[model samples]
Target: MAAAQGVRGCLLRGPLRARLGRGCSSGAPVRQQQQQALVAAPAPAQELPSTRRKGFLTEHAAPFSAFLTDNFGRQHNYLRISLTEKCNLRCQYCMPEEGVQLTPKSELLTTQEIITLARLFVKEGVDKIRLTGGEPLIRPDVVDIVAQLYKLEGLQTIAVTTNGINLARLLPRLKEAGLDAINISLDTLVPAKFEFIVRRKGFHKVMEGINKAVELGYNPVKVNCVVMRGLNEDELLDFVALTKNQPLDVRFIEYMPFDGNKWNFKKMVSYKEMLDTVRQRWPDLEKLPCEASSTAKAYKVPDFQGQISFITSMSEHFCGSCNRLRITADGNLKVCLFGNSEVSLRDHLRSGASEDKLVQIIGEAVGRKKKQHAGMFNISQMKNRPMILIGG
Candidate 1:
């Protein structure tokens, strides 16, 4: 989980050009100033009155909105929209090696439908939207989608969670289109292992994408690594070493079960295990403050320019302050990532539901959200969509 987890920051140019400062450097300690501008934007902070989810949006959350707030008073401000389910690579963990039954193109949300839902969410008090996919860069009009979302008055940030295959050539266009943050999935630092994991020959391309993102001034470009035992776990330090000079937020994600990919407890690398692995190398690893809604437990090594974090979705869950809502590529609104229940926004839109009617449907779905998802073991056993379909 990266954008699939949550996103932070805003664009320095394009639609947000008037609001952000201009300057690019590869030497900044962290987010530097572009993010500061986003933080100072006119949108209200995401503060929730609830004291349950510790360190979450207390004073920093936006004003409560009936449509966005759940029964627990967790004000949801982040929305992740899956651009498409089609992926160029066949990652072993993302989809079954035999592959999944792809949805017909006609069933997927059209560009306009995505934009319409985006505008609706912005009006409903959702400030951050992350574009996800089997690989979002595969879509030809993704840049245009970001452009349209950026133009929304109250929308504060636009991010993409990509496999980084086509990112090298498209990042500039995406930035010009008002794209703010990016999360690239790279589970292995080794080229051969990359091919083995993704079942594709695009390691060089992914590496190129990472370098290009940094070169183009997307500070703290998030690198998502799904840590699996007996696989790429040995390269944890190699991934962490990436943050020594670059402004990359290297996030280690715990592998969770879905409909396929054969997820099991043995493959999971817990948060504590990952933290201990990194701390063994850098005894000075320091814990960084994180938002209550944040799924990743952020940390940074002493004097390191970038930081390292862990998404403890398995070993430990952060559902208490959960503020994220996901829309599948086909436009089904999933309130919880692990929850199988969904309401079809695409179906409603296609059925000619009014804006107010759609809002009511979305609010009803949000209202039914549980205080938390099932435990890790139960989640693995329960039926859920594959990570690829869920847009993680």
Candidate 2:
């Protein structure tokens, strides 16, 4: 009642499709000019032309509808942008309490660059974009970015994933800028535990943000909780209770390993363990069919007003249906969340690579997407930036 809320892609290759319009010469200046033009003028929304070549995805194809498709036949319409690597809180699982080193402000992608790349993806068939960050709300220009992205022709959804600290202040402007949904990360129900996990004294602020989000009619406002052994695992039931009255989606994620988190297998609270715990408390809990491309396995408590989902990225891999891509704050594209490979769109953009070249680079990278990530057994060998740097 008192303590709630809070805490916390790829490339491909290809020839320039005709409908994509206005191919540019290969060079940094020419590409920058073309990117500038795109930012200046977003194409009007319309059906994309059919692309039926044996190696390409057909227009409007359900799963592989995007202009870029991987070897596994996954269409990627969801794009996650990391606005910055600088965060306010030092979550135990995300980064060091002392803070990790960050890229210089000059090197991070500019709002214009983000818009340019976002337009390219939307043109290529991305319909959904999520703004993420060390703390997206911390970036003063985030609302403007969201407003610009909403004007893109084919983009149907704009969302943000935040720690909910600044959401109270930013939600109205973001909502006005065409934001569609929000996912707030609040790992524990206890203020002391929240302070312990996040290494900050912002629990009340986060709760206020959550309450504001609900008040503002952010339908299906999601609360993301990362459950770990010997830590917040005891709060699983407490989180589920959140959905009983409010139209929230309380997602419990398995504790995952990344660089500098001191991760170990013993710390993971498996999805099965979580589901069982919920069932024991609510024998009538119902499983809900989830979107094929969604990472979570969804459920609802009988007569509950909201839902619960489990992002079993570690214990249960959903790679076959994974449809999301990530662009780091500095402009590298990550096709797979757990993968180490990144194609630098920022470098290419600044170097003056043509839009067609950028498309080709993206396609080639997506082509190399693995069928699945190396699981728990090889978890130690997987190299990745800390979760904060990688974006939530």
Candidate 3:
């Protein structure tokens, strides 16, 4: 994640976007002066994570002088910024039946405010940033935001996780704005199933957008499928077949508990179960090499064009090597996805806190990070935001 901002001309990014494919290239000029950015930001701020080892990720576990680094000697170089909490789809697994209460517009970060925080994190040690939300594309200024983030000198990869409801139309503009990686959420292929899962009518639009992403040369377009026990477990083979002919990375995520997701142990699917199920069909699935900080366990078929992986968040937590940080749409810094504790960076910033003060706030919150999140059973009982509100 410490890799710097030189991944242009179809260059592959760090562990954040591990799918195999050539990424889009862009060289647009930056206009940082136009925005109300942090004029008093740390001077001589690093363009990359470590000035000692520039333009490359610090592969070893050695500690660096990054503010994002916690006490456990983990350096967080990947930042997930929630663009908004408003999603176009209401997937049964992501949201509760009653739905999440939306954060007020006045409390949310403006485009300029988001840019400020992004700049701050990059200046600290963040090299890769993934824009997430209920649906980031729904934001009218998403393309502009992408363009601005691309302009950051030392930031390496710019990625987004969307439902693909509006990707087909804005993909060209987004690609031109320097988006290096993308993960589209598609839990079901059947149109009726899609509608049932999301409680919406954009199944065709989502499929069209996926095809468009593949057509537009986003190599190894990642398709995120949240696997549930009775709902979509039977479709695992169908998802694996997708990788046979295309550079698609179908990641089967384990169903997890959120505030309203009605998570139960019975609904959860373990990584071993999914792998065993696949091995039954092929009997020759190959494990792929990945970085230590990677959350997904990647694998592929013998001669398939694509690969598959599993996010073992429930059965097997990857907190020991976690190098990621999350910022809610409302500007709260969440050190862990399963942790409900948060520090309002928005509050500090709005109160006219200086750059040094902001660093102290961020460091304090990061310092309070637990060695690992609570167990699945305990986490289900804890109160936390729904997945949609927290940014998928």
Number of clashing pairs per prediction, in order = 10, 18, 1
TM-score of model number 3: 0.85
Q: After superposition, how far is residue 44 of candidate 2 from its true place, in Å?
A: 34
Over the stretch 351-373, how does candidate 2's per-residue lDDT look in tens digits? 99998678778877876777788
- Please identify model 2 stretches exceeding 4 Å from their true place: 1-67
Candidates in order have lDDT scores of 0.79, 0.76, 0.77
RMSD of each: 7.0, 11.6, 8.9
Point out the worst 10-residue segment of candidate 3 by lDDT. 27-36
Off by over 4 Å in 1: 1-62
Q: What is the per-residue lDDT of model 3 for residues 1-392, given as tens digits with 9 covering 90 to 100?
A: 12222111122222221223225521111222211121111211123323433322233322222356555555677789999998888899888888788999999999999999988877665667899998999999999999999877556678888899999999999999888778989898788888889999898888888888888887778889999888989999999998999888899999999988889899888999999999999899999976566788999999998899899999999888787899999999999999999999999999999986887678667757777889989999998999987885
Q: Which residue window of length 10 is worst by lDDT in model 2?
A: 1-10
Instruction: Judging by TM-score against the true structure, name the best candidate.
Output: 1
Q: Residues 1-392, candidate 1, lDDT per residue (tens digit)?
A: 11111211221111222334323322121333443333322222233343432223222332334555565666676899999999999988889888888899999999999999988887766667899988888998998898888788666678888999899999899888877788999999999999899998999999999999999988888999999999999999999999999999999999988887898899898889988988899999999876556778889998888999899898888887787899999999999999999999999999999987887788778867887888988998888888899997
Instruction: Write the number of the candidate with greater lDDT, choosing between 2 and 3.
Output: 3
Can you rank all candidates by lDDT, best first? 1, 3, 2
